[model samples]
Target: MYELKEREMIFVFTGPHGAGRKTVAEMSGSTLGIKQVISCTTRPQRPTEVDGQDYHFITAEQFNEAQAKDEFIEVTRVNDYLYGIKNSDIEKIFKSSGSIYLILNRFGAETLQALYGDHVVRIFIYADRDTLEQRMRESGDSEELIATYLSHYEDEMAYREQCEHVFENVDLAHTVFDLTKTLDQYLNRNLLELD
Candidate 1:
């Protein structure tokens, strides 16, 4: 049987862009009462996102200043935009919850694991190339950027084995179900009262 230690855990979901990492993380966080780490980003916020909720949208200068202060636990540059998770945010969650969900890039996920050791549960998510492209397009990404992401997909997927669990996100609802079930088994909880 699969096992995760009994304690509040840091759940980090990561994968190539358009693989539904954020979608699944949001669903799981809502259902399981897990706090999510809202990352700070230099990218423009989408219309559907609210400031401080989906992300803490910031200027590049602000991001740079924070980075210089050693405030972020991990930082990555994607398509020229900077994305990072604040160290204080993770520390607060660790002190206050049964679990916390982090939607991260592969680099951020790796950094979390290295920093937190056994308290971190890494879940790698992915989908077929066509599905990835479709999701990216649906999100209004430009063709040039989509191509760039596609080109990096293989390299991103190569980190799969380094993760503690891996899921292929083919269908959002079904995938969410499976992920929550896996989390229930992993953390030993009826996280959503599904029983």
Candidate 2:
């Protein structure tokens, strides 16, 4: 059976595209010494992103083959691309870290929550639509792709109520500070319960 160690936990970062979920997750994870479980995606890599660091960019065939082999713990299709987290990746992180974070969509977060129950913490981060669009534009996304992302914003925002924590990511530094503090409290509480 799959199980986390007493100190291990999974943090799922979820929100609409360009909501700063990845930024917040990375910043908080760095501050808290939590590793990030790099996910595999069939989307084309951006010029600024590193292949293995940002994501495991794979071909559609490769993604399908891995999914067929039951390698992914959760998989979701968004904007005509596939994204998933592999079971092995989580295990690999746990070998050296007590906690890990995953950048996921609403569906992916729900899947992990169902699988891990209390062991998974779901956090939803969001920004104003204008901010979101500007972020996407700054990231070099095409206008069409940005529009496609925005089209799903409402659906993504609707999931915020289901998350254990929600933050408006207008200011990155402040958001990261708040997130780190909250995560620390959660981890401490879990430790107390374990004892």
Candidate 3:
């Protein structure tokens, strides 16, 4: 049986589609030496995405089976696809790292906060609608996909006030720099308290 030596710090990044939450999370994780909590999804993989790297792409049956077994820590349905984080995945990260970041939607982040309490930090990222649309187009998203994402944008943005930190991600470099710096300070302060 494996056990974590210390409580893990969970940073949850939530935002509307094309707001660059995933990109910022990845960059901040790399800069801070923190691992990412990759999620499992039933959605079809994009052309540039890797199966296990970007997401654990599974069949709907597989997702249902996992859910039936109570394997998911947080799960949600979006656009008819299931997305979830597995308990085992967090355990795997905690075996080697003390902190991890998750790219999640508002509901997923809320679930994590309910489970982890103070160990969870919720950060909301956003950009103007025009900027978001431009980003999706530049990333090769289909017009249909862009439309679907934008349709839900306002609803997602409404959750921004519920987050602990909010960032306007107009400039990727600045956002990544500020985010990583903030995370570093937070971790250091928490570690000192633990000591």
Candidate 4:
């Protein structure tokens, strides 16, 4: 028997590279008026990124401190980098609205769902392999790397079933409209007002 709880939820989204899940999640979070649970990372700051805008861009020492304190909802190593979404960010989002969204890796989504139960709504984003490769090339990665990454898609295909929703990010041109529609449905409202 399953009982539904009405507490605030964590709307998590995951996808393969160049699928635009991160962009869609950010837009959805902004539209919903909740903090998007931006993570802290050990990766170097990119040219367009501020100290904390894109990521916390912390040193290994700082990240280790927070990790030791168990301050993160999920933490993992990805692409030779340390990435973590802090519990404080989750608390911040929940404090403001009836629901919160976290853009996470597939692993994080599963971990959070296990801990939060029905409070976690997972969305898996997908794009055709060719389109994904094209987008990755446009984003400046080498073709070889893009091909290597795309090869993993087949192995990771089963992960999509783990999510509550599977979004196909085909045409990048109309991504906003599609994302907005999904958010509206997920929140069950045309307008989401943040507290």
Candidate 4 Cα deviation (angstroms), residue 119: 0.8
**lDDT per residue as tens, model 1, 1-195:** 112246768899988999989889889777777899789999998877899988999999999999999898789888899999987887677666777888888888888788778888899999989999998899888899899999999988999999988999998898888888888775676555445
Model 3, runs deviating above 4 Å:
1-7, 189-195
Candidate 3 lDDT trough over 10 residues, lowest sum: 186-195
| TM-score of each candidate structure, all chains considered together | 0.88, 0.93, 0.92, 0.83
Q: List the global CA lDDT of all models.
A: 0.85, 0.91, 0.89, 0.75
lDDT of 3: 0.89
Predictions ranked by lDDT, top down? Answer: 2, 3, 1, 4
What's model 2's lDDT at 54?
92
Best by lDDT: 2
**Clash pairs (backbone) in predicted model 2:** none
Candidate 2, 1-195: lDDT as tens digits: 258877679999999999999889999998788999999999999888999999999999999999999999889998789999999999988889888899999999999999998899999999999999999999888999999999999999999999999999999998998888899986773322221
Model 4 residue runs over 4 Å out of place are: 1-5, 143-148, 172-179, 190-195
True-vs-predicted CA distance for residue 34, candidate 2, Å: 0.1
Q: Model 3 reaches what TM-score against the true structure?
A: 0.92
What alpha-carbon RMSD in Å does predicted model 2 have with respect to the real structure? 3.9
Stretches > 4 Å off in candidate 1? 1-6, 191-195
Clashing residue pairs, candidate 3?
none
Best by TM-score: 2
The residue-level lDDT of candidate 4 at 108 comes to 78
